[model samples]
Target: MRNVVIGFLGTQLDMGKRRRWRPTVDLCRTEGFPVDRLELIHDHKFNRLAHSVKRDIEEASPETEVLLHRMDMDDPWDLEEVYTKLFDFASDYGFDEDRERYHIHLTTGTHVGQICWFLLSESRHIPAALIQTGPPRGGDDVGTFDLIDLDLSRYDALQQRFDQQTREYGDLLKGGIKTRNVAYNRLIDRIEQVAGLSDAPILLQGESGTGKSELAQRIYELKLQRRRVKGRLVHVNCATLRGGTANATLFGQRRSFTGQAGTERAGLLREADGGVLFLDEIDALGLEEQALLLHAIEAGQYYPLGSDAEVTSRFQVIAGASGDLSAMVSEGVFRIDLLTRLNLWTFHLPALRDRPEDFEVNLRHELAQAEKTLGIRVGFNSDASEAWLRFASAPGTLWPGNFRDFSGAILRLCTLAPRGRITRAQVVDEIATLERRWRAADTDQNSQLVAKYVNGPVDPFDIPQLANVLHTCQTSATISEAGRRLFAVSREDRKSRNDADRLRKYLAKFDLSWAELNDG
Candidate 1:
């Protein structure tokens, strides 16, 4: 097997044969174990030193290809930066594990560099065995080396933990197996591992209908299975938390004192004590409430509306936001520090439109669910199944609603199928029905948008005409300006050029004046 070595060039790597031997030179010269390649990474500051080491290795073993790469990092002591650069370099380069067996040389460079190499090897980013070199044992110029293959399975505790967590995730999958999406399943696996390992706050970000709420519930269920949590999974929609009532609802209401609102019962935080708390649309939380929530997360203590004694709830907060909290933070709508606390583990659920490949699988899963819920087993004939697949999996079909749309399609199919088996005709009718429904909804939405300009109701049938007229008027600053715009195009062809009067006549057609639309 061809052995490839990856490591950072140390300050002592090129030390001549005074008291010790060089790792690169010795590894290449080791008897009966020829290294096919030595990939040395170093900063630009070590350009001359790197060149000298490369020459020494070449001289020691002309067969070994000593490929030197210049890595960009400001500090060798910065573990994050060093690890990131090395990981990126390994990813960008052709480090194909199928082509060669690799070894990570951890003996050279700073201690931070060695640790980064170890982590990269552990994570399989380097896809190599970690090799640590020691001083020559026989007092010769060569050194002794230890090669460690970082296979977690070999470690009983870690392997068992991984297996147990994976099994728990598989259990969670049972509750929402509406699709066989590989990417999504892999995401679930990662989430399962994170959920098992940490109860730290998790942030779920995705568009609407991406199943964030369901996933959060499943995570809670898995935790329950593992006995990680001891209380109920308390969920609260932050969108509903508005005004003074929002604070009382979240933190707890104070008992009534004349002319004051009293919250005698426990709030969401208290309800979720020692359990999982899911906050949906977390961005909707007001600034003051956000501060209190932040304090709760940090200190696990908060005062109720009317009480001075700080009530406590050791709740594991999983906040969900439909949009980017960072953007909101930039706009001063969200607290940066609070976001930073929740940002530790953020998972983005992708929209359904991007995963069309899983449509058929999801279609079947949804049907299975319908079978249980509707109390009737439904089967799709060959032709109907094929037809549905064509429309559902087609690139042009935008499933803007994601999984929710998929479920809705199944609902429509199940509701319409009079017989147990679905036929091609039914599929055609349903597709047509959905198309018309979506188009009408789109048109209605457009009409409603146009309606925002009018102070009073306009004829719904005339929305298209009114929209066209309003769009044209917006092209110019005033009625006269708009009139000139229209006349500019047609004045040459018209017998009489009365621009403003013509504009006035058009406005009269819509029962609207220029001032009405442009009142800023």
Candidate 2:
């Protein structure tokens, strides 16, 4: 490992305050990991600290590769430019290997360094370890020295999180898992069939946290493998997109245009060409931006920010929204023409309550994952699981947060449980806490009505007009007689719907129906 070349990109003040470079150099000397080079990247803001560290490094290791990359953390380089520079520099120093062997140690000491670190890791899919600066031993007045320790677990944890995210979101890419959901599955299958193998634009409609972005990623990965598209996956959260100096963030902008000096940056779409472009919370985009996106999807082109150069953006476009884009278009909140362009394909991810069966498997997967992440053991036995199911299946469990809520609940139980084995009562207690939280948010009359409906009358025969009779019978056989009588007309016809069709058909629960509500 002494042959390994390490580059340090962080703050000069931070380096001195935390003693980051000294400890690393010491470790290199002690552990036989040769410190071949040292590059202290700093801005004008840290001029004093930069000069000091530069002199110290020269005295400590005269032969070390000392470079002072002068640029503001924010203005220095965007993620793509950083990748371009780092790879170029690495190649210049003969750091290339057939496999992924070149290691870049990004030290986060300032806001800019942290952002670069996050962006590089995300864009390049590179593995990294975090090292925090600590106080010196028996030093007075917050010792100005960096104590560095490798955060090895961060890599594994990030990988596991990424893996779980892929499975959960990847499942939604095509038509999703049919065995887990009939209504949703059929819709997904139909949509996939409609989308065909061509790179048609896809629009996803659902509330926030419903995994719309995940679905978009899944589509990209699947289509890449299926169609063998030779491009990278690019995702952007439209809600967080900003203009101003951040123009280079979403769209490439001129480096010399601003008072700051830097190189021109590349837009995200350009980097993602040939693969997939996922525009998350697309409804948040202004009308003009929406038009630009529409033109890109339709005409396969767009203009980079602060530039007259028209860049061709020919890639699979997938947009997600929390509300009905069609309605927004009609109400003039969104553009109708743009909506038509996106309506070429649409997929709606069902909420948790809408697909109860998925919960059992999803919950199990979540628990297993949580156990692995937290380094704790946890599981549910038959009785405890039954209790959980009862609580989770109860009415008003729309779980607006969907699988995220389930994951949170399981993780909470794991954290609170004794010796890792969570019981049904523990689940119930958590539910009570959750309910309390809901109640706290329920100050208005509508919330009170919801509270009444969820916690009030136990009307066994209460059935919504849309409730399925077969599903009711399957869930509770005691309601079979009532359901048969309630659907007597259909029974007289001597016809029964298939399982998938059954969900759409009406069934009597607690012997209640639209007529009973009318009578009341």
Candidate 3:
């Protein structure tokens, strides 16, 4: 195979002295590694030097063919210009990998030029290996050369640096909270990647208080830090946008349209121009608004309220929804086309109950934040800390409100602490309050589930039992598991152990099936 060497003409080294072997000429003259062709790149001002170096290469290695290419640059140190020119050159160059091997000579260019070459080659825009030449050692005038292949996996330090950077990005997205849940950490990793790499609309689906809004803000901040965006973040709770004002609030309003003397208002989309727009509770947006948003996202232009001219605002959308958008689309409540655009990068944050391992870590984080906000440090005593830990790790501990409830609990504990020290008594009281709140919520939810299934009025005596049974069935993975738990004590005494049959018959009495309960 033929060998092609591409490099810049070293203005000083390739000129003046024969005693010091020129890097470009020596590369061609190097023993055992013969250059079949040399594609010499240089500024038009250095045309004389390029020809001089070319002549020297021809004399030193008669087998090598030297080709001169004049690439003019105002500032050789300007990275953008150098990269653009080099990228263009690479794009136009005919590469034959099967017949010829390409080598990018790194010793002869400016540092900026060298960096551009590395980037182009690493990204495979230039299909070549990098060859770096140094001064001659021993008897060889050709000098020592090192061939560097841009295989990231071969460089452990570089790979490790990339991994560390990804972890840092994940940490930023998590608001510096030390989370230990494996699934949650993986989710953050994926979000970090998407936030940095893509400008397509992102759909965040999760229950209320699961940090969708917070995550969107973190994504905005990350993109801003990376200089992907220049404008400020615009956060809008779609639930607050209602009736006629919803249109004005999102797409701006003209003073003439309102028949008022006030100045025209730039809406959330305009405010987020060149930045990010976080639409929390996006499912609450009216179908008409959703359609307009879809158009704005796709076209980067929209008609504001009472405005004849179209307003342009190029922004990325990060929408948050507590409910299932797909279900809403099926029910004809949400615009399917809008949902399709936002669903390009969909992420579902897990509920706090599903991420129990992260509860304690997040609790500590909340307490620290509270301390900073309240201007007082609060410490949980050993006994108090243990008590809280037990409650957090307990089986079937419902965190229906997710992180909001957890953070609120920590804030309450800190606020109610005496003299910056939370005692066991305070912890006990907080636990009782949380348990009562959870129980009442569970009871109400269970009653609603019962009402949905049963046709006639349920006997007052049977309400509590029916509610408990329904709650257990919904939480359990299968009828067998539900039956085992519901009849734990009574199952052992039975001669025939058919707990599932007993549970099925009981559910039948209420006109409910396990499948129906779960599907609902």
Candidate 4:
């Protein structure tokens, strides 16, 4: 394979002192690593120097071919301009990997140029290994040269730095909480990669309060930190956009349409130009809005309400959905095209009940947040801490509202704690309040289920017990499992171990049968 060396013509280094040889000329005369062709990149101002270097290279190694490529740069230190120019040059260059091996010389350019070269090579924009040249250490004028392959996995230190960076990105998304849930951590890792690497529309699917909005904001912030975005993050809850005004609110409306003397409004889409648009509860968007959004996302152009001129807003979308958008599309309530675009990078955040392992970590985080907000450092007593953990980590505990419910509980505990100390009494009280709130939210749905079985209106006192029993029955695989769970404390005392029969007897009170319930 022919060896092709591409580098910037070092104006000062190539024009060396009286005794020293030019680095480029010396590189051509390298002992074993022979350069078949040297592609020297320089500006118009250094044309004479480039020619002189080429002449010296030809004299040093008569077999090597020297090609001068002119790349004009107002400032070689401007990373963006230098990178773009170099990228264009590399793109235009005819590269044949089968016949020619490429090497990017890093010793010639400015530090900024060197960085751009490294980025381009590492990203495989230029299919080449980096060749760095240094001054001669001994009597050999060719100097010492090192070949650095762009494959990062070959270097343990570089790989470790990348791994650390990935972890930091995950941590940022997690609000600095060191979550121990294996599945959640893996999900965060994938999200971190997608957030940094791609601008494709991201669909965050999870139950309400599962940190979808928070994760979207964090993704925007991460992109901003990486300089991937310039404009601010525009957050809009699609659920809030309703009625005829939804169209005007999202895509903007002219003052003439409003029939008022006010400035034209640039809607959420335009507001998010050059940045990110976080549409929380995106499934709530009407069909018309969804179609318009799809067009904007795909074409980067959309017409505002009552406007003929199409406005362009090239923004990345991080959509949040609590409900199943695919199911909605099946039902003809959602646009399949929009869902298809958004589904390219979908991440489902697990519910709090599903990730019990992260309870303690999130608990501590919420406590710290509560302390900061309340301006008081509250500490839980040993017994209180144990009680809190036990209740939160219980098998039957259901966190329907996920982190929001958990955070609210912690805030309440901190708020109600006496003298900045939460004792067992406070823990017990908070647990009761949480259980009551959760049960109250389920009462209406559970009551309807109970009403279907019973002949008459159920007593308010028996409703909670019946609701719990019905829920257990619906969720359990078999009658025995439900019975074992429901009568767990009392079953040990009973000599007869017919749990199914016991469950049947209990259900018989409301004229409900196991087979009938399961069949229904």
Q: What's the C-alpha lDDT at position 88 in model 2?
A: 55
Q: Which stretches of candidate 4 lie over 4 Å from their true place?
A: 1-25, 31-128, 132-149, 154-156, 446-520
**Candidate 3 error regions (>4 Å):** 1-4, 7-27, 30-58, 62-102, 106-119, 125-127, 131-161, 444-520
Q: Which ten residues in a row have the lowest lDDT in candidate 3?
A: 13-22
Q: How displaced is residue 270 in candidate 4, in Å?
A: 2.0
* Cα error of candidate 3 at position 125, Å: 4.8
Best by TM-score: 3
Point out the higher-scoring one by lDDT: 1 or 2: 1
TM-score of 2: 0.51
Each prediction's RMSD to truth: 11.3, 20.3, 7.5, 8.6
lDDT of 2 at 209: 72
Q: What are the lDDT scores of the predictions, listed in order?
A: 0.82, 0.61, 0.89, 0.89
Clashing pairs in 4: none
Q: Per-residue lDDT for 343-410 in model 3, tens only?
A: 99999999888887887788789889999978999999998888888888787677788888888888
Residue 303's lDDT in candidate 2:
70
Rank order (by lDDT, best first) = 4, 3, 1, 2
lDDT digits (tens) for residues 1-520 of candidate 2: 3333344534443464655435334322322334455555556787776676667666766665556665454445466565555445434554334532323444444344446555444454333333333334564433233323234345788778866654554355532443477786676556544444667788898877777776667667666656646698788888777555334566677665565677577787787778788888888877767776677677776777767778886677788999778766755769999888887777787777877767777777778879898998788867888888877877877675676777788899888888878887887898887777655543333433333324444333332322333223433323344455456566556556233233223323334343332222
Each candidate's clash count: 1, 11, 0, 0
